[model samples]
Each structure stands twice: as structure tokens, then as C-alpha cells.
Target: MNRTARLYALVEELRAAAPRPVTVAALAARFEVSTRTVQRDLQALMAARIPVRAVPGRGGGWSIDPGMTLPPIHLTAGEASALTTALAAVDAATPYADAARSAAQKIEAAMAGPAAAAARELARRIVTLPRPGDSAIRTAVERALAEGTVLLLSYRDAAGHESDRAVEPAGLLAADGRWYLIAWCRTRRAGRGFRLDRITAAAPTGERAQPHDLAELLSGSAAAGAVRPTALGPLPVAIA
Candidate 1:
């Protein structure tokens, strides 16, 4: 791998193999570089203020600070329940499911004392069911909203009509065991909510989602009217 990739890989390796120092010779051999090069790379990482440390002696090596790897998250018992509760409502096979699971793990890992026990106990009692194909639309709509990009979508509506349209996806809502994409439909010249299951494909347009339209969606007044029982209000993004 190139230096940049190697540097990042080194960090991952240190983080994963942490508490157990990875010897310089082992790192060099793993990266297919000389000992000197590995040493310089480690120094560079340290100089850049990455939480790396070198242990001494014959068995000693390099290690990353475990505390440095902790994710920044803290949740009240109610907050934790609400989050895991919402996530449980979504399908486990969705594209973002693993991401949600990992975030949940990190959130729990960051907790300690009584809070952690409560979270773990509550998690045992709460279960959310997910629609199998809801992941596609969720991933697409979320990306479009986050990047402020237009999306080219192949959508099948309620009547089973299939059509391709370029849409500016402004926001997303999950309601009644379903997912919806709220977007400015180029074909209809209006904002519409398309069901997640109906989307066959979604591709980014590399164009900016119009500011006014995005603002209109973010304003809640316009987006709320886009779909029934739609709660398009901005919610806190916990871990993911």
C-alpha cells in the first residue's frame, strides 16, 4: 500500500491490536517496509499528535491509547431507550443496519456504572422489526440529504408505474413501518414523498440540491405537508 493508506492502516492496526504492543519488526514486516521506515512513520504519526506510544524492552513495542479510541457519546436512560427503540423499528438487513448496530455498541461501550447496566437491561426488553427492502431508500435519501445533492431515481409508485426522475431529496421520514423520501421531483415540479419499497435505483446527480427547496424542506411547514403523519423535524444524530 501507499504511504497514506499505510499510515491509516497503521492506526487501525494499533487500535485493534491495542493493549498488546505491536513490535516494530512485526509492523515493518506486515507493511513490507524496513524497520527504519516503520520507525519514521510511527514518529510522524506521533508528531501529528496521534495518541501513539512506544513501550520499551525486549517484548515492548508500539500501542495506541485506548482512551483515544472512545467515541463521543452519552445518553440518558430515556434517550438510549428512544434511540435503540427507533432503530429496532428498522430492518436489520438494511444497508445502514450494521452501522446502527456498531453505533449502539459504541454508545454502550462509552457508558459505565449504573447507566450501562440500565441500557443493557432495557435493550434486552425492546425489539424493533424492519421491512426487508427499506434499507435502499433509507441509504439513498440519507445520502442525498446529507450531501445536498440531487438524485436520479428509478421509482415504482403505488400503481406499479415505473419511471426514472431526477429528484432533489431534501429529507426522510419513517412512519407506520415504512420509509419515505421527500424530494423536489423534477418531473412533477413539486415536492413529493416516495415510498422506500418503490425505489428500484438511486444515483447522485453531482449537482447541488436547490437552496430554497432544501430550506423549504428543512422549515418543517412545507415538508410536513409533503406526506401524511410525516414528522420531518430535525432529530438528534446520536452516534451515526
Candidate 2:
């Protein structure tokens, strides 16, 4: 199970045994993960404001207040299939790709057995082409964007000239059947769009990115018209 699904399952497990603590070791065993990993997951749940409590001492463990949790979701076969189709469209080049898959799995897992089977069959009828890109580079770019950090990139331009660059990830753009990482290039001292396929290597620098207006930068670019203002305009002001 991916971490996202595991987190969701962890909540369900606690909710099912509400008011009674389930030990960390037991949770680790149930999830087939290390106790340390369970601890981290618990911390993440807490960070997300989940109503989980860590009780102390013997016979103590983790528990959630069921009253505070949402009721089970029930999706029709067609609805579930619709979700699958949408999530499947999130390719390796997109951010949160893993999370999207995890969410789809959770949705299926939540469905009634027959409904889930029908959903699967319906999803199979729709075909999609595989996206081409390096998973490692995609992961690095996703992390840089998620954490608001600087990224180190090894890039080969159209001229086949290779160079190393440190950039602040601003956003991603999909144009002309390709994905581009829109970033503030430190080397060029300006905003630039680097094609994902041309990125030979990518790594997070672990440094927080300096603040910049991504929409303003994109508006000034030659490809500005190719990108819709609504794409960057609808973003929460705090995010911008």
C-alpha cells in the first residue's frame, strides 16, 4: 500500500475500534510497516488535524473519536469509474501522481464488491496512452513543488548543450504533448520553462524557495497565450 492509502486505512482502523486504544506495534503489524513508520504516520495524521489520540502507559495505544469522523462513502459503479478515469489521467509527469493512484485505490476499496468489479470493468473500456518521462525526475520535481524548495537539475537544451542548474519550482505546464517544469532559473536569473524530457537529473536542494509571483512570470513569456490565465488565476491568493 502507498503511504496515502495506508494513512487512510490507519484512520479507519482506529475508527472501527474507537474509544479503545490500538497499540503502535499492532498498527505496524496490521499495516506491514515498521513501528517507526507507524509513528510517523500517526504524526502526519495529527498534523492533518485528524482526531487521533496517543494514550500513554500499558494497554494504551492510538485511538480516534468516531463521532468526529465522516461516515462511510458509497459510490455507484459509474461514479467510481469516473473517479478512476480522472485519476488515471494524472501521469508520471504530474505532481501528486502517487497520491492520485492511492486515492483511486482507496475509492475502489471502499466500494461494495459488485460495484467495485463493475467500476473496474468500466474503467478497462477506456484507453489512455502511456506518458513518457523519468519517474525519478518527476519525483524530485514533485517534492520541490510540494515543499517549496530549490531544485538542482541536469538539463539538455534543444541544442543538446548540457548544463547544471538550480531553480525554484513555480509550476508545471503541459503543452504540445509535453510537460514542462516552470521555474525560476538561478543560472539565467529569470523564469524559464524546462522540458521534463530534457531533464537528465533532478534533486531537491532542501533550501526553501524565494518568493516569486508565478502568474506574473508566465504572463511575460512568449508561451503566455498558450497557457490560460485561469490556469494560474484560480490559485488561492495565499498559494500565489
Candidate 3:
């Protein structure tokens, strides 16, 4: 379209054709431009100190330095828009929300010119606000899951009882616009799900979490259903 956009596209084209000759006729026909225009554009590229070398012989044309890499990879404007839009659909209170935001930033950084602009426009149409300060707890849960670290938690039940217990963070679950941490309770010695909002405090126990897959740990099994009167905080409950 515009000369500036065309220049960027040309750079990408040459990069894709690196170490291999791309005849001026092909470049010109691909862009629907005259041979003179292609020659002038190549001359401008040379003037800009780009390493575009000429190939000799009947089959030879123009080629870029084999070592040169322009964008590294190609992500079209449409693809970028779709990815950001999908990220926008994640719930705001979960660990994934923070990660999605960070991913969106990286995607934006990779896109340039009109592609970046289009992605921003698409993003504006898909609005979401991640919960404030959610990263603090979310990071802890994610780290615990990743490193298999045990966690010491100060949690409150839905009925307003509070207690301190140790758990092994399993996996994160998002449902009904709320966040929940599914974990293996050391006290109850069973798997349970705790609402993230109810976790008043959490700290690492410096111990490794027991090896357990989230699906198998939670499959067909329930926590110690009855919380011992003397041990009210042992089981957080899966369906509270």
C-alpha cells in the first residue's frame, strides 16, 4: 500500500528469501510495481546500509545476507488480533488473568506499524479488568504448583470459620467469574478446593508438595467431609 508499509513488507520478503536470490521481476510482479520501482527500492535499501547482495548468471538475482534476520518470525495482523482477543476472555481474578496480560504485552511488542495498531483496535473492543493485587497471591499459587512447594495458608471457610493449615497447591480453576485453588490438604490428607478470596494469607512451607495430578487427585474423591469439631480447619471442602 503505502511506501513505508511496502518497505517493511519488502524487508520481510527479503528476509524470507535470505541466502537465496529473488529476481527483481518476481518482486515487482508480487507488488504489482514496475521493474524500475523495484530497482529504486533496492537502491534505497542499499543506501540504508542493508546487506543486499547481487547474484550473477542467468538464474541469479538479488539476495540478502544469510545471517540477517529481520522480524525473526512472521505473525500477521489478523493472527495477533485473534490471540489478544482470546486472552481478553479470561476471568480477572485468576492466575491466568495476570499471565494473559503479560502475554498480550509481549505480543504487542512483537507487532509493528499497522499490525500493532490493528491489534490495539481489536483489544479495545474486548474489554476486561483484572482484579487488583491478585498477582501477589496468584504468583504464590502458580509458583507452588510449578515447584511442587507446600504452602502454609491462613484461610477462612464460607461459613466464616478461620484457621491455619498446610497444603500442596494443585491446579487453578476459574468458574462463575470466581477463582479457586485446588490443593491437597496435609491436615485432612485429601484433595480440596479453596476459594482464593477466602485465603487471608499464604506462605511457602519450604517442603516439596507430594506428587499428585490435579485430575486424579480430585477424581471421584471428596475431602474429609466432616470437619472434626476440634479440627475445624482441616478440610476446606470442595463444594462449599
Candidate 4:
């Protein structure tokens, strides 16, 4: 590898070793370069908005701040193919408005030269069939999941009656080209799956629900044809 590439790899190694700080001297010794070269690499990382902090004095070195996002990976042909396939599946299942574009941008930024161009070209040639979903419903589900809020939804039942219901948003599932919210219902006192497209209105109650075991909730017994109703437990009552 060239000096620049070798330095970049060293930076990656240091970041992976965090939260343990790595000294410049150690990096120089590992790469058979001078401390000045290591310092230059650290500067490059800082310029790219990596949260690198330098500690002065003996036994001190550099560490990356936790929670800083890492740059995307540079993908080989095989890796690029795998990533595109997985992304395509996600895109088809959820059809998020921004996710595919954001992924493409990240992939392009991570790769270089012909590899980058080929990845982009392959992505363009690939297509995924999307399931129908109300973007608003999907957005509301995402919000509830992130905020841990209960949702008040206006839904159309199988009989086509539009009624309001309160549900504890447990999680989202995609099955057979449809999106379903697996939640605990306040009125029914049981878990239920609601179709995203049938949801006419969704409003967050601003009250967070108790934690639910996601793994058990999504296990084999909870599969599409399963009749198990109470997978985790009774959903907690609203906190007053």
C-alpha cells in the first residue's frame, strides 16, 4: 500500500481500538514511519470531521470521541454487490423516501476510481419492487419507535369501519409485500398487527410505553400464521 493508504489504515486501526487512546509513537512504529507522518494522518482525520483528541505528556496519546459517526467503508466488488442486495431488500420492504439516496451517496463517498464508478453503475442498473405504504403512517411509526410514544390511530378495520384506537407501538414488521405495526392495544388489552396503509390518522400520545422484549415479540411463534396473541406481556398502563 502507498503511504497515504497505509496511514489511513492506521487511523482505522486506532479508531477501532478506542476508547483506548493510541500514541503517535506506537502508530509510527507499527507503520515504520516517523511521528510526523502519523501526526499528519491525524490532521487529515480531524479535517474530515472525525472527533480525534490528542493528549499531551508521557503515556498520553490520541482518542476518538465516542458517538462520532465513522465514514462509510470502501467496498470491493464482492462487498459492493452484497451491500446493494441488502439495501435493495430494505428499500423494497420499507420504501423510505430518503434511505436509498442516502445509502448511494455514502457508498460513492467511501469508494474511489473505477470501483466507485462500478458500484454506482451497478446500483443504477438494480431495481427493487416496493410494497404500498402511506409515507405518513411510516413516518409516524418511525417517530413513535424513536420517541417510545404510544400512538392514537384512526384505522379502517376489515369490515371497513373507521374508528380511533390507542396502541403501544412495539415495533414494525414487513411481510408478504405489506408493512404491519406490531403493537399493544389499550382497548383490547392484547397485541395486534395493524396494516400501515389502512391507518388513516396517527398521533403520538407523548407518553412512552414500557420496554418490550423485541426478540421474543418477533420470534417464530409470532410468525405470520401464528395465533399467539400475548407475546411479551401486558402493555403498561399510561403514566399519569
How well is each residue in 1-240 modelled by candidate 3, as lDDT tens digits? 766566556777888877788999999998999989888888877765667877989889998885644464567788788887777667655665666866676577667788889888887888666554455676777778878999988889999999888998877665566667888888888888888888888787679878777776667745323222343356666985
Query: Which candidate model has the greater TM-score, 2 or 4?
Result: 2
TM-score, every prediction: 0.56, 0.67, 0.57, 0.58
What lDDT tens digits, residue by residue, belong to model 4 across residues 1-240? 565477457657777878888898888888888999889888977765557879778778998765665544555776865565456456533735445645655455556777767766776777766656566777777788878889999999889998888988877776666777888888887677788878898888789886665545555545645343453468778998
Clashes of 2: 0
Q: Model 4 RMSD to the real structure?
A: 10.5
Arrange candidates, best lDDT first: 2, 3, 1, 4
Q: Which ranges in model 1 have alpha carbons more than 4 Å from their true place?
A: 1-89, 92-98, 134-137, 212-240
lDDT of 2 by residue, 3-86 (tens): 877888999999988899999999999999999999999998897677899999989999999997775676667778788767
Q: After aligning candidate 2 to the native by TM-score, how far in Å is the CA of 192 from where it should be?
A: 0.5
Mind giving the per-residue lDDT tens digits that candidate 1 earns over 1-240? 767668767888888888899999999999999999999999988875678999998789999987776433446777776666555444543546655775576456545677768777777787655456655556766677778999999998888899999988766666566666778889998777777778888877679978435446535543454443324466768996
The RMSD of every model to the true structure, in order and in angstroms, is: 10.7, 8.0, 14.2, 10.5
Greater-lDDT candidate between 1 and 3: 3
> For candidate 2, what is the lDDT?
0.84
lDDT of 2 at 92: 71
Error of 3 at 38 (Å): 34
Point out where model 3 deviates above 4 Å.
1-74, 88-92, 129-133, 221-240
lDDT at position 200, candidate 1: 89
lDDT of residue 179 for candidate 3: 68
**Candidate 3, poorest ten consecutive residues by summed lDDT:** 223-232
Tell me the spans in candidate 2 whose CA falls farther than 4 Å from its real position. Answer: 1-10, 13-60, 63-77, 226-240
Residue 45, model 4, lDDT: 72
Task: Give the C-alpha miss distance for residue 159 in model 3, angstroms.
Answer: 0.8
